[model samples]
Target: MTVQPIVFFPDQRLRQVAAPVVAFDKSLHDLSIDLLDTLRAAPGIGITGPHIGINLRVVVLDLPTSDAPEFYVNPEITWLSDDKVQNEEGSISMPEISAPVERPTSIKIRYADLHGNIHEGEAAGLRSVCLQHEIDQLNGIFWLQRLSSLRRNRLIARYKKLGHA
Candidate 1:
């Protein structure tokens, strides 16, 4: 597994919707491995296909409290709790100060496994956050997109100023 370069914010490609994973092919498996490698390098909980410029509906996640890597393909949130709370959220692309955003307390998600088997499960806490973050990528949305327009603009400017845009 090799670490893939992360596509940072302000890149228009980040705003493009990812395509669904059609089959469990060699390339798809390789992408998943690379995503795990990249996520480990980021020292973060999750990584999405789009972040590595793949534009396929795949994500790799490993919470700080967990060691086993989790993979999701064409994942969809099937349910969400009404209770919500605000927390500081960060991203591989932004790599800036974590911005506070309100998100559901829990979510039930469905996705295909590496072997092309469908699976559904509930996730809370960091896993939930990771799921929501990665799912947003599948739809061409970022965590910062949940922020106010002014704040989003400011963050983009900051990234540009940092020479990462």
Candidate 2:
């Protein structure tokens, strides 16, 4: 496992649509490990392939106090609840400001594991938020995008002032 550099906002690669894994190869497993390593080292709850400019549909995450991490490959939302909870969220890619964004408290996700095994998981609370956030990154969307226009503008201004955008 190796720590990979995270790409910041406005990077073209972050907006690139990622390619899905055709085979569960050793390279994909290694990449997941690296992403987990980077996420842990950065002290972040999650990280995506696009965040590292890999343009691959992969994401890794662990809850705030969880020691066990989970990896998702080609993850997609299978179902979502209409019930939403607004949580203050931040990202390693943009550390300047955290804003409240509403997301489902529970979600169903389907993905292939490192071993080429397909699985489905139900996530609620922080796990749900983390899943949605990372999946958004795969779709070229950021958590900040969930904020209201005014808040998003304010955040961008703050990030610009901090020289992080």
Candidate 3:
């Protein structure tokens, strides 16, 4: 597996919806590995295929609380709790910028595994936030979309000040 170059923010690729993963073959597995490598190299807790310009519905998250990293293919949120929490969220594509994003405190999700088996699971706290964020990327909604326009603009200015477009 290789660490693919990240598709930075403002790139149209990050705005395009990722295509569904139809074939769960060796390529998909390798892509998942590459995503994990890229995520680690990017030094972020989460990343998606769209983040690397693959435009495939895939996400890899390596949370410190987990024993190992996990990959999700074609993941979709099935249910969201009414309880909400605003946590500081950031994206690897838009580095050096983050804003408080309010999302469900818990979520039930359905996704395809590398082997093409469908599974359902639930997550809460940071894990919940990460899944929601990555899934948004798959749906062509950048994390910034979750923020208010004012806050989003301010962060973009800060990102520009940091010498990144």
Candidate 4:
């Protein structure tokens, strides 16, 4: 698997909604492998197709300390718990910044595996947060947008100051 180049924040393609993955074939499998490799190299827990400018609803996640990586195709949040938690969130696109974002403590999601097998499950804690973040990217919502305006501005300013914006 090759490490794909990541599309950074402010790229117009990052704002485009990803198209659903229709075919579960060799190419899709290859893309999933590339995503895993890219995310691993980024040293990030999660990544989406848009992060690499693929424009397909694919996500790869390998939480820190986990032995295996997970791949999701066309993932959608089906339900969110009323209880909420604030977790520090960041993006590979905007690597230099992170801020606490309030999100549901638990989420139910529906997605397909690389072979097009449907799966539905609940996620909590960091897994929940990571799934929401990556799915948001698939839906054209950048993680920074979840931040308050003031925090977003501050984070962007810091990124710019670091010559990464």
- Among the numbered candidates, top TM-score falls to 3
lDDT of 2 by residue, 1-165 (tens): 789998887677776778898878898988999888888887788998988878899988877667788888899999999999988898878876798888988999999888879998898989899899889889988777788899899889999999886
Relative to the true structure, candidate 3 reaches a TM of 0.98
- For each candidate, the alpha-carbon lDDT, in order, equals 0.87, 0.86, 0.93, 0.92
Task: Report the poorest 10 consecutive residues by lDDT, candidate 4.
Answer: 63-72
lDDT of residue 133 for candidate 4: 90
Q: What is the TM-score of each candidate against the true structure?
A: 0.94, 0.94, 0.98, 0.97
Between candidates 3 and 4, the lDDT winner: 3
The sequence of per-residue lDDT tens digits that candidate 3 reaches over residues 70-93 is: 889999999999999999999999
Q: For model 3, state the Cα shift of residue 54 in Å.
A: 0.3
Q: Model 4: runs farther than 4 Å from truth?
A: none
Which model, 1 or 3, shows the larger lDDT?
Answer: 3
Shift of residue 40 alpha carbon in model 4, Å: 0.8
After superposition on all CA atoms, what RMSD does each candidate show versus the true structure? Answer: 1.3, 1.3, 0.7, 0.9
lDDT of 2: 0.86
Give Cα distance to truth, residue 55, candidate 1, Å: 0.8
